[model samples]
Target: MEPFQWKQAAKGPSLFYLSSWMEGEALTAGFTGRDGGFSKAPWQSLNMGLHVNDDSKTVVRNRIAVTEALGWPFESWTCAEQVHGARVHIVSASERGRGRDVREDAILDADALITNEPGTLLASLYADCVPLYFYDPVHRAVGLAHAGWKGTVAQIARHTVEAMTAQYGSHPSELLAAIGPSIEDCCYEVDGPVISKVEPLLKELREGGASMAPNALIADANGRARINLKEINRQIMIKAGILPTCIELSQMCTGCRTDLFFSHRMEQGKTGRMASWIGMGRGEPFS
Candidate 1:
């Protein structure tokens, strides 16, 4: 079964809940779909990013809807100013609500956010980029990362795992990770310039004993390689010491499934963004 289960409502925002890791009341982790809110076209409904040209108030409304669905307080929402870099930020209680409604308040220049702080809902925006999730049940830590090709090559996944290890004493082998929806090899073909950057990374993964899929990077007559970013990222996690059995990979290709995701590649450059969120809650609410 797909760990990220589609929990669609008749007339509300469509969400992909990370069900496998939600067995306890202490954590909430999942990705959002492109529906059920109130933004106009281009960003038409459920746009969680405030940086896009969408109306800031409307984007805030979309975000509030997701928090309502997750039953988390809007005051706990936290975010990072993603720059496709490998920088990581640890969110404490003081940083809980930063960037929940505005762009300038986001954690500066961080592509990954991890927190052992309870009630801080960590969020990162996505369109076709992969959403990497991490959870440490023993230390009660959780993380969210946005891995575009640049971030993937920069090893944002490894950085997130290491951040949790250093900040909360969480071990990579014991951490649970999940790679959410993104463009797959079927729809993501890169020319030589992009392939050149990725080739050396793949070389390192092979040298490190990563079990890459045979089709992880397929070559064609045009001298371009169709890259399997999800698998590549998975192997990167393996290289970072995360156990293979503890990782979950989603098969929903954003480029192929436009009905469910906003594909930046398939849609050219105009589209809304989705939110990938994770947080460790304090306890059961009195409400």
Candidate 2:
């Protein structure tokens, strides 16, 4: 629940794991910090959001850099035009090049995506909202979700797991979840209305306790509350039947680290997006 950071290693990006989920297969995942991209100024480096006033070409180049840094081919990575809804897409080999050509528009109105095919990289962009990655090696399945407060309150992460189970027969006990970087409670203050909508679910996870009441979670400073997105998502994963030890969360707040990540809330909409992804590999290690 406390803020944490992944030290920048000399070899590559900040790679980490959810102990329960990191077992078995080889997979690499993490957020792209403000370093290692081709953008300048507000966009800075490693900016992955294309609609944030950054050059389209530059975003493509930046994305290639990110994919390559992970030892994955740029051509294999698949992205979507996020619309902040709960719609989930099941990516297939035929849909691999849906949005790469710039000449063709990518699938729209989806906030989450999953794939069971190897070498199929599925990703969802992020700014301040939390990015979650799911993997079920037992089922050879994986999922990615972008949870802004709306999506979080809607329990999109839980939805993804359920979708995986229904579609791919994934058992939560065998699933691994990773919560990527996002706005933390220290910097993610919110109003009472938002807290009111999500309190019931929070309460249910806390064993139906009263500590998660709307007023209890709100702060007096802004006459609102500062909800811990990381904690909220973690609790959702548990309630969805995911083992706590199977979840890995990045405790960094995007808003607080404007110099390292794009925070839409902190930057007031003048920021780029970060990419959080998950994929299943068929023949090679994800590494």
Candidate 3:
């Protein structure tokens, strides 16, 4: 069965939840869909990102709706100003609610956010870029990372794991991870420029005992290849010592499911973004 279960709230935003993880623990982990918000036209309804040319007030409203639907307060939402870099920010209690309403206050120049602080939700915006989630049940820490091809090549996945380990003393082997919805290989084709950069990273992962699916990065005679970024990141996690059995992969493709997800590639770069979030209160071991 697919890990992310789709649910439409009666008066709330459409969501794809990592329900098994939420049910077994105090954590709430999921990705937002492209419906049930108040944004108009290209971003019509359920747009959770403020940087996508959506009105600030409407974006805040949509964010509030998501918080309410999760039974969490809006003040608990913390965001990152992603620059496609590998910088992983460690969020604490003092950092709660940054960028909940505006972009200026966001944790700047970071693509990954990790926190062991309870009640502080970690969120990042995504259109076609992959969302990488991390949870260290050993240290009660949760993390979220945004990975476009740039961030992926920068090794954002491995950096997130290292950050959690360094800050929370989290052992990568004990981490539970999830690769959220994004553009899969079927709809993600890249030319030589991108391929040149990604090849080195894939080569390193391969040398480190990390394997990739055949469709993960397929090349054509024309110098372009269909890349499964999600799988590539998964291999990165493995290279970083995260157990393969502990990782969950979402099968929903943003490009094919544009009706449910906002796909930047499919929409010609004129689309809103979905948000991936994960947080939990202080708690005991995973149930």
User: What is the RMSD, in Å, between candidate 1 and the native fold over all Cα?
Assistant: 1.9
TM-score of 3: 0.97
RMSD of each: 1.9, 3.5, 1.9
Candidate 1 lDDT by residue in tens digits, 1-287: 78888887777788898887877466778899998989999988888988879999999998998888888888888998889999999888888899998899989999999888888999999998999999998889899888988999999999989888889999999999999999999999999998888989999999988778987899899899899889989999999999999999998999999898888889897889999998876444311
| Decreasing lDDT order of the candidates | 3, 1, 2
The true-versus-predicted C-alpha distance at residue 116 of model 3, in Å, is 0.5
lDDT of 3 at 253: 96
Clashes of 2: 2
Model 2: how far is 179 from its true place, Å?
1.1
Q: What is the TM-score of each candidate against the true structure?
A: 0.97, 0.86, 0.97
Give lDDT tens digits, candidate 2, residues 163-185: 99999999999998888788887
- lDDT for each residue of candidate 3 in 90-199, tens digit (9 for 90 to 100): 99899999999999999999999999998999999999999999999888999999999999999999999999999999999999999999999999999999999999
Better of 1 and 2 by TM-score: 1
How does candidate 3 score on lDDT? Answer: 0.91
